[model samples]
Target: MQLQQWAEQAASQQDWSTALQLIELAAWQEPDNPQILCRWGDWLAAAGQPEEAIAAYQAVLEFQPGCPQSIAAWAAVLNEQGQFAEAIALLDQASEQTADLWHQRAVALQSLGDWPQALTSCDSALQLDPTAAESQFLRSKLRLGLGDWSQGSPEYESRLLVFSELRDRLPSFGCPLWQGEDLTNKTLLIWGEQGYGDQIQFVRYLSVLHDRWPETPLLLLVSEPLVDLFRQLAIANLQVATQFTFETESAYDFHLPLLSLPERLGATADVIPLAQGYLPRSLQSEIRLQANPRQLQVGFVWQAGETSDRRYQWRQASKSVPLEQFLQLRLQVNHCQFWSLQVGPARQSLLQNWDWADCDLADRMHSFADTAAVLNQMDLLITVDTAIAHLAGALEIPTWLLLPKFADWRWSLTGSETPWYQSMRLYRQAIAGDWRSVFEQLQQDLNSRPY
Candidate 1:
């Protein structure tokens, strides 16, 4: 017990190595203790050792059969390993019914594209504990996946409570959140949230906001990287800033996150304000294309930006494809000239060997503005689920987006098209984490197309 207390203290202090060591020692001292074994499993899972964590959970379940905590924790690790069916089966066997177990079941069902079942599980969980923000958030995503945006958009507010880090980073203003209130002659500040792709996708709503409140001044607080790209909107009475420190002298009246615009305007999948492109076309760059003029000028992005957050790690891994896999497309397709639209350190590593594409823009694209300018020259854009895909979709470029089997809610389930972007075509993986099948289908489609 003393060792476990010391381990908790060490963990709270962020000394994970010492905390893990302490937990291991405590487990050794009390081998048959389910509580100790569960704690050891949690530490192992947090340490990115899912296999070891699964073993620990299995040990706990052996001693205490059908333990709700062990079952829920084990199911979560199984889901992370992409064993959704197995996770769901284990969740079904849990003797104790708890909100957490229901939530775990909901997640596993959602991953398997069982939206109706997932929503039912979410409802069951929420009925038990209405304040379960994570379940509510998942419910919102399930609703969106099922194209019930009227319900989903309103429930989406639970995200702030669900993702605590996002809530912590949010700039709080004493002003009330804008909820379709009259903004006549009043200033409204709309701030960006989440990833760069989210900012780019939702920025189109600014035009809708501007149109509604033509007389009202609109202040957009966006990320530093996107500041330059958003500046080109040039909406009357609109201002863009990278940061906002709420002060008495501030020019805004009401503040809202960019995503909340959908709920405020009562937007659904059917009415996603500005279904076509919204961004102004960038002036063509002086950079010359080295590709054959007769062939299709296609740009491709293979990976998303790297992140340390465990919540995002699995999504990033599933979405990203190896550079070697894209090289196969180069070898198979001869009608199109491929251009590397990839940015960041990953691009640098891919460009080291240097013999795949006609031109590389890794050194040139520093911001979204630069990438937008380059994307303008391409006839077609091929990319994974990344910011570049959203950028291309926003620009109204003909974009082919490659998606994993369990893709984001925005792409929805069982579709080759999204209502968000008219020019974008989705190519989804037939099996989870199988990029080879996606690429093979993509090659066939490219060959059959009249480009």
Candidate 2:
């Protein structure tokens, strides 16, 4: 078997020792082979040996100079290690060596928050390959960040081709593109995309469409995670459907992605629906005991997901704050009740710092519904860009959404508010993974609030 295939199998089976051995053998057999070297670097990086990966990639330049893959991979490692300047330099070199290299360079620059430079790259990328899905997707992201929705909206459609598997599963073997025209009296099927927060952000467009075309039949094709929450809307002629039962007939006249609504509605910050207190319901007495009213009821969520079984999985999980950060904030804010809205058990130990006086709601709530019941009484939700923020936004409750600097396009970079949720406020890190500023801002914002 080829070393690459063997290594892939080893990694798949979590036989990292075998994978490492195979990569080393491959590297020795072809020391000057850039592809082999780059693969070794990938394995090293995936194994949490980024420093070694950087060396492996750097060695590739000795034989095959200006190799884009090597340059891009090395730059990525550098970026991960916070060496943004070095990473940008490498990406720039790679871009100049090839046509449309600016796209990769632009992404590197975007990671560094150089939007103007990123824009220049996007222009170059579009010039070289206007039809390229990635270039268009990145352009859309940069445009959204630049507050240029007119251009970004169309670019967002690039995802349909970029993630072809998702497109393949759709009724049509293409993105459910819409012109954002009238849908009154017509049954419009809208499906969610990407993450839960995405669904929440996009659903705001539903309310907008419904109001504009009150006569339209809105059939929302939602995920199992959100059916119960969306069912609460139950607007006349509005139906929530999950699980594609083939027996169910195709019933909609038009369709669009949940994320596409912003483009359709021409949403900007000034026109956002910013209402307050979305999910208004009292919890049972037993549930109520889990929250303390004297302390400002603050809900916390850290960590995103743990799907990958590799060294990098640890880093993906690190997107959340260590438990001490939450504990410190709970104490610093003073007179605040702390509760966890986190979904998984892997990081529950982080709450050990909080006194028993603070309730740990992580285990008590079974799903979003149980969590929503607790959130209904919350004074505030301080969470990363996860589903709970979406839930809070959907209910029109006051929520502070902490976003990574490159944030989802739906948030739009120019504002403290999102058009999707009137009561939702945004706290963005100045740089990706830099949460200190966001936390500081959250503390200040909470202090200024009436609640």
Tens-digit lDDT string for candidate 1 (1-451)? 9999999998888787898999899989999899989988888888888999999999999999999999999988887777789998998888889998999899888888788999999999999899999899999999987889989999999998877666875556667788889888789988898899999999998888888878888888887789879888858977787786333346677989898998998777877766689887764556666768888889988898777765557677788888888788888988888889888777776667657533677777878888888888889999989999989988899999988898888998878888899999999989887788888888898888765
Pairs clashing in candidate 1?
none
Instruction: Return the TM-score for each candidate structure.
Output: 0.93, 0.80
Where is model 1 more than 4 Å wrong at Cα?
245-249, 284-288, 448-451
Residue 272 miss distance in model 2 (angstroms): 3.1
In candidate 1, residue 390 scores what lDDT? Answer: 89
Q: For model 2, how does the per-residue alpha-carbon lDDT over 1-451 read when each residue is reduced to its tens digit?
A: 3986898789888677788899889888877778888888887887878888889988998877788878877876775565667777777666344424566577667766678788887788778666777778878877876777778776788877766556675666233456776675567778778766667656656777777888887778877767766666636667776755423565666677777777777776445553443343443334664555566777877666654444124334435665656766776787677777777764457655446424667766765566667788788888776778878876655787776665555665556876667777877777666778777777777677664
| Candidate achieving the largest lDDT | 1
| Backbone steric clashes in candidate 1, count | 0
lDDT of 1: 0.85
Clashing pairs in 2: 185-215, 185-216, 273-422, 274-422, 275-422, 278-395, 278-396, 278-397
